[model samples]
Target: MTVAVEFIVNQLKQVLLEEQVSTNETVRQLHGKDESHHALSLPDIVVFPRSTADVSAILKIAHVERVPVVPFGVGSSLEGNAIPIAHGISIDFSEMNAILEIRPDDLLVKVQPGVTRSQLNKELKKHGLQFTVDPGADATLGGMAATNASGTTAVRYGVMRDQVRDLEVVLSDGSVIHTGNLAAKSSSGYHLNGLFVGSEGTLGCFTELTLQVYGIPEFVTAGRAIFGTVADAVSAVTALLQAGIAIGRVELVDEDSIQQANIYNETAFAEKPTLFLEFHGNEAGMQEDIAFTEAIFEDFNCLSVEFEQDNAARNKLWEARHSLAYAYIHAYPGKKLMSTDVCVPISKLAETISYAREQLDIAELAGGIVGHVGDGNFHALLMLNPNDPQEQAKADHFNEQIVQYALLRGGTCTGEHGVGIGKMKYQSTEHGAALAAMKSIKTALDPYNIMNPGKIFT
Candidate 1:
C-alpha cells in the first residue's frame, strides 16, 4: 500500500529547513483555525516555507497534486481568513520572518511575509520611523495586507492597502512577480495591488512586501472625553472630525467596556461612555488642536475631558484601548467572542451605532461596542456561549440584524475583517452584480480553487 502525496512531501521536507511537510494530526491542528468565532478544521498537511522559492515550489507541487493550499500567519485573524477548511496543505510563513531592507532615504521598508507589525516597528524605532496600522494584535504584515486590516490609527494613516507600495507575490503556477513599484502612486497595469491587498490569499501568496512608513512625530498628547451617553461620545468624534483636527487616534469605547478594562487591566478608569483621543504635531500646533477639540467636545455635551501629556501616560491610555476585546474575554469565562464591524458615512454613524446598541439589548448579549469612530466605523462584540445552542442563536440573530441594517444604509458588512465564511452570506446583498465580477477574477486567478477554498465565496 502507498500514500499518494506523502512520499513527495517527505522528499520536499528533507531539504527545507523549517518545512513541517508532515501529515501529523498535531501539525494539522496547529494551522487549522485563527482567533475568530468560526469552528476549526484541520488540514491534512502543514508546510513552513522559508523563502519565495520555497513557497513557489510548494504551490507548484500542490497544484499538480490537486491539494489545496492555505497561508497561515500568527493565527491572530479576527475573521476565519487563516482557517484551512479544504484539508490539504497548510503553508505557515513564520519561518520567513525577516526585514529584507530598510530604505530610510525613501521612507519605505521591504520585508518578508512572516514579519509581524510590532517586530517591524521595534526595528524601525532606531531609524525614527513607524508603521501605523495597529490592529490590536501584533499580526504578521502579510496577514494584515491579506485582510486589508486597519485599526484606531487607520482613521488618520489609512489601512494596510494604503501603506503597501509594492508586493512580491508567488502565483499558483510558481511564477514570481511584482505588483507595483516604489513610486508614491502608480496608474500602471491592472491595479494588481488593489486586487491582492484584500484578496485573503485566494489569488497568490505574498513573499515580499514594500510598505510606506512615517517618521515619529515631534509631540504627542492623549486624552479621554467622557460622556453621559454613547450618542454624546459619538457626536464629539463627528464634530472633531468636521472641525478638521489633526488627530492621530480617535477610539469610541463604551462605559461597559471601560468597566471591563478596569477589571481586566487592573487600572482605574471611570465607567462612562468615553472617547480615547490623541493628537500628533509640534507642541504649539498640538496645543491649538487640543483646544479646538475640547471646545467641540464641550459643544457636544461632553461631561468631562482630561489630557495626559507625558509619553508614559499616553502609552497607558492607548494600551487600555487596545485591550478592549481581551477585556470581554476575561470578564466572561467559557464564552466565545464574536465581533461585527460596519463602516458608514460620517453622517450615518450615530444612527448606525444607536441601532446596534438596541440589537445588543434586544438579544440580551453581554458585550461592548468600540472601534475607530473617527472613520465612522464601529464594531459590536458579543460574548457568546459556543456550546449553548440557544445563546449561539441569539448572537447569530444579533449579527444578522446588525449587518442587514448596515447593508440597507449603504454600509459594508465588514469594514476590515475581510469576507471570510462569516461575512460570505452578505456578499450577494452587498455587492449584487459586482459579486459576479469578483467571482470571475477568483476563477481566472485560481481555476482549481486550491487556494483558500470555501472562503469569501465558494
Candidate 2:
C-alpha cells in the first residue's frame, strides 16, 4: 500500500469503532469486485460507517490525505461501480443499514444508504407498503442511488432516482447537505437531487435517503406471451407500451434464454421468445388492463399468451425472470458473463433488438437476450471464456458494436447500470459535449477524486 493509503487506514483504525474499521478483515477477495466484467482490485482498508458522522469523519481524513474512498454496499453492481480501483479506503455501509422511518400515509420512507432493497421491502411490508425499484439483484439502496438503477418495475414506477425524494450527502470536504425536501414535487433551482442520483459516487457519499413508496395493490396479475421470433416479441412490447397500458412489468426473454433458464432453474418454460408480463391495480381494472394487453399482443402476432392466476404461479413467473442472469452464470461455470445494456425509445425498440439479434447471429456466439422491454431497454448476456484471449476479444467486439449502434440511434450506452469502468469508454459518445459538464461536476464535488475513482467519467 502507498504511504497515503496506509496513513488513511491507520487513521480509520484509530477513530472508527471496532466493528467499523479493519484493514486485515477488509482486504478480502469479495470486496474487490462487483457483478461486472471488470478485473478485481482490492482496497488497502475497508471502513464501515454507521452514520453520517462516521462517513464525514472518514471523508475528511481521506480528503486531506488524497486517498481514494469507495462507498460499497451489497456489491451487486453490473459496471464495476463498487470496485476500489485506486486502492485506498473501501467504505462498506452494511453496518449503517437501518430503516429509520416509514410514513404509511404519504407512502415514503427514510432509510440509511446501506439498506438493501429486500431488507427495506421487508420493513415496508408491515405498513402494506413497498419500494418499487427492483433491479433483480439484492443491491444496496446507496449503490442503487449512486448508479440510479432501474429494473422491470421501472417501466411503470420509475427508477431509483424517481423513487428518491431526498438525499443526505457528504461532500469531499466532509460537509453534509440534503439535496431535496419532502414535498412531492419541486420547481427549485439547480435540481441537485437529479444531479447526484446517478453520479456513481463521484459527487458525494450518500448518508441517508428518503424515498417514495407505494401501498400494496389490491390485486396483482401475471402473464406470459410467446412469439414466433424475438422480433415479434419486441414488436409486441413496443405496441403495448404505445397503447398506454398501465403495465407493472413487461420483460422479454429469447428462446436461448428460456433454454438456459430451464437448464439452470430446473423448470420447464416453453423454449421460445416470450414476454413475461405483470399488472397491478384493483381486480376489475387489472383484468381490463390485461385484456387490452392480450389483444395488443395478439395484434402483434403473438403465438400464445398464458396467465398465472395463483400467487405461487405469479411468484414463479417473476422468479424466472429475475433468475435470468444467474441462469446464464450457471450455464458457464468456468466462464464469465458479459452483459451489455442499451435502451432506445419505444419506437426504435423493435429495430434495435432486431439489429442486436442479427449481430449475435453473425458472430455465432451463444448468448441470450432479455430485458424490461416496456421501457425499451434490453441486455444481451454474452457468456465467454475470459481466459481465452480470442473469446474475450470477440465478446468485447460484440459489446462495442451494440453500444455503438445504440449511440448512433440516439440511445444511451447504459440505461440502468451506471457508467462504471465497463461503460466509461462510451461516455463521450453517449453524452457528447455534456460529458465535459459531468466531468466538471465530478471535479467540483470531488477535487481529490478519492470517492470511487476510475468510475463513470474516470
Candidate 3:
C-alpha cells in the first residue's frame, strides 16, 4: 500500500472498530464495482460506518490526508456510481441499515443510508403505506436518491427526487447539514434537496434521508397488451396519456425482450411487442380506466389484451417485467450487460423508440428495448463480450448514437442512471454552460475532491 493510504487507514482504525476497517482483498473487491459493465477498480480499504458521527470521522481523516472517499450502499448502481475508481477508501453503509422513523400520519419516513427499498416497504405495509419509487432492484434509498432513480411507478408516483424530503449529509470537511425539512412544500432557501439527490455522491455523503410515502391504492389491476410493432405500442401510450387516463404503470417491451423473458421465466407469452400495464383507484374507477385502456389499445391495432385482477397473478405479471434485465444476463453467459436509457418528450417517444430499434438493428448487437413508456423513458439492454475490443467499440458507438439522438430531441443522455463514469463524456453536451456552474459548486463544497472523485464531471 502507498504510505499515504496506509497512514489514512491507520488513522481511520483509531476512530472505528478494527473489524469495521478492512483491507481484506475480498472485502475491497466487493466494494469496488457496481452492477455496471464498467471495469472493476478496487479501493485500498473498505470501512463500515454505523452512524453519522462515524461518517464524519472518516471524512475528516480523508479530507485532511487528501484521500479519496466513495460512499457505497448495496452496489446496485447501473453506471458504476459506487465504484471507487481512484482506489482510496470505500465507506460501505451496510452496517447503518436502519429505519430511523416512520410518521405515517405525515406521510414521511426517516431512514439511514443503508436501508433498501424493499426492506422499508415491508415495514410500511403494516401502516397501509408504500414508498413509490420502484427501480426494479431492491436498491438502497441512499443510492437511489444519489441517482434520482425511477421505474415503472414513476409515471404515477414520481421519481426518487420527488420522494426525498430531506437529507442529512456530511461534507468533505467533516461538517454535517440537512438539505431540507419535513414540510410538504416550501419556497424557502435553495433547492438543496434537488441538488443533493442527483449529485451522485460528488458533493457530499448522505447519512440519513427523510422521504415521502403514499398509502396503498384502494384497488389495483395489472394487464398486458400485445401489438404488431413497437411503434404501435408506443403510440398507444401517447394516446392514453393525451386522453387523461390515470395509469399506475405502463411499460413497453419489444419482441426480443419478450422472447428472452419467455425462455428465462418459462412463460408462454407471445413473442411480440407488448405493453405491460397497471391501474390504481377505487374498484369502480379502476374498472372504468381498464375499459378505457383496452379500447385505446384496440384502436392502436393491439392484437390482444389480458388483465390479471388476482393479487398473485398481478404480482407474477409485474415480476416478469422487473426480471427482464436478469433474463438478458442469464441468456448471455459470457457477456456483460450494458444498459443505457434516455428520456424524450411524450410526443417524440414513438419516433425516438423507432430510431433506437433501427440503430440497434444496424449495429448488429445482441440487445433488447424496454421502457417505462408512460413517462417517455426507455432502456436498451445490450450484451457485449467485455474481452472483445471490437464488440465493445460497437456497443460504445451504439450508445453514443442513442444519446445524441435524445439530446437533439430535447431529452437527457441519461434518464435515471446518474452521470457515473459511463455517462461522464456526455455531460458537457447535455448541460453545456450549466456544467460550469456545477463544477463551481463541487469545488466550493468539496475543495479537496475527496468525495467520489472522477464522477459526474470527467
Candidate 4:
C-alpha cells in the first residue's frame, strides 16, 4: 500500500473498531465494483460504519486526508454507482442496517442506509403497508435513493425521489444535515431532497432516510397481454394511459425477452411481444379498470389478454418478469450484461422503441428489449463478451445510438439508472447548458470530489 493510504487507514482505525475497518485485499476487492459492466476499480480500504456518527467520523478522516470516499450499499447498482473509481476509502453501510421507525398512521418509515427493499416490506407487511419504488432487485434503500431508481410501479407510485421525504446526509466535510422533513408538502427552503437523492453520492453520503410508503391495496389483479409486434404493445400502453386507466404496473417485454423468460423460467408463455400488467383498487373499481385495459389492448391489435386474480398466479407472473435480466445472463454464459435505459415522451414511446429494435437489429447484437412502458421508460439488455474488444465496441455504439435518439426526442439518456460511468458521455448533450449549474453545485457541496468521485460527471 502507498504510505499515504496506509497513514489514512491508521487514522481511520483510531476512530472505528478494528473489526469495522479493513485494508484486506478481499474486502477492498468486494467494494471495488457493483453489478455494472464497467471496469472494476479497487478502493484502498473498506470501512463499515455502524451509525450516522460513525459515517460522519469516516468522512471527517477522509476529508482531512483529501481522500475519495465512495458510499456502498449491497452493490446492486446497474451503472457502477457504488464503484470506487478513485481508489480511496469505501464506506460500506452493512453494519448500520436497521429499520429505525415505521409511523403507520402517517404512512412514513425511517430506515438506516443499509436496509434493503424486501427487508422493509417484510416488516411493513404486518402493518398492511408497502414501500413501492421497486427496482426489481433487493437493493438497499440508500442505493435506491442514490440512483433515484424506479421500476414497474413508478408509473403509479412515482420514483425514488417522490418517496424520499427526508434524508440524513453526511456532507463531504463530515457535517451531517437533513435534506427534508416528515411534512407531506413544503415550500420551505431549497429542495435539497431532490438534489441529494439522485446525486449518486457525489455530494454526500446518506446515513438514514425517511421515506413515504403506501398501504397494501385492497384488490389486486395481474394480466398478460400479447401483441403481434412491439409497436402494437407499446401503442397499447400509451392508449391505456391516455384513456385514463389506473394501471398499477405495466411492463413490456419483446419476443426475444419472452423466449428468454420461457427458457430460463421454464414457463410456457407465448414467444411474442407482451405486456405484463397489474391493477390496484376496490374489487369493483379494479374490475372496471381491467375491462377498460382489455378493450384498449384489443383496439391496439392485441392477440390475447388474460387476467388472474389469484395471488400465487400474480406473484408467479411477476417472478418471470423480474427474472428476465437473469434469464439473459444465464442464456449468454461468459457474456456480461450492458443494459441501456432510456425514457421518452409517452407519445413517442412507440416510435422510439421501433427505432431501438431497428438499431438492435442493425447492430447484430444478442439483446432483448424490455421496459416499464406505462411511464415511457425501457431498456435494451445487450450481452457482450467482455474479452472481445470488437464486440464491446459494437455494444457501445448500440447504446450510444439509443441514448442519442432519446435525447433528440426530448427524453433522458438514463431514465432511472444514475449516471455512473456508463452514461457519463451523454450528460452534456442531455443537460446542455444546465450541466454547468450541476457542476457548480457539485463543486460547492464536494470541493474535493471525495463523495463517489468519477460519477454523474466526466
Identify the runs in model 4 with alpha carbons over 4 angstroms from their true place.
none
Model 1 local distance difference test score: 0.88
lDDT of 3 by residue, 103-172 (tens): 9999999999899999999999999999999999999999999999999999999999999899999999
What is the Cα-based TM-score of model 1?
0.97
Global lDDT of each candidate: 0.88, 0.87, 0.93, 0.92
Tens-place lDDT digits, model 4, residues 1-458? 88998899789889998899899999888998888899989999999999888999999988888999999999989998989889898989898889999999999999999999999999999999999998999999999999999999999999999999999999999999999999999999999999998899899999999999999999999989999999999998888999988889999999999999999989899999999999998999888888888778788899999988999999989999998889999999999998889999999999999999999999999998999999999999999999999999998888888898999999999989989998899999998899999999999998888888889996
Give lDDT tens digits, candidate 1, residues 84-194: 877787888999899999999999999999999999999999999999998889999999999999998987899999999999998877789999999998666798898
User: How many steric clashes between backbone atoms does each model show?
Assistant: 0, 0, 0, 0
Which candidate number has the best lDDT?
Answer: 3
Give the higher-lDDT candidate: 3 or 4.
Answer: 3
Which segments of model 3 are wrong by more than 4 Å? none
Worst 10 residues of 1 by lDDT: 11-20
Candidate 1 collision pairs? none
Residue 64 lDDT (model 1): 74
Better of 1 and 3 by lDDT: 3
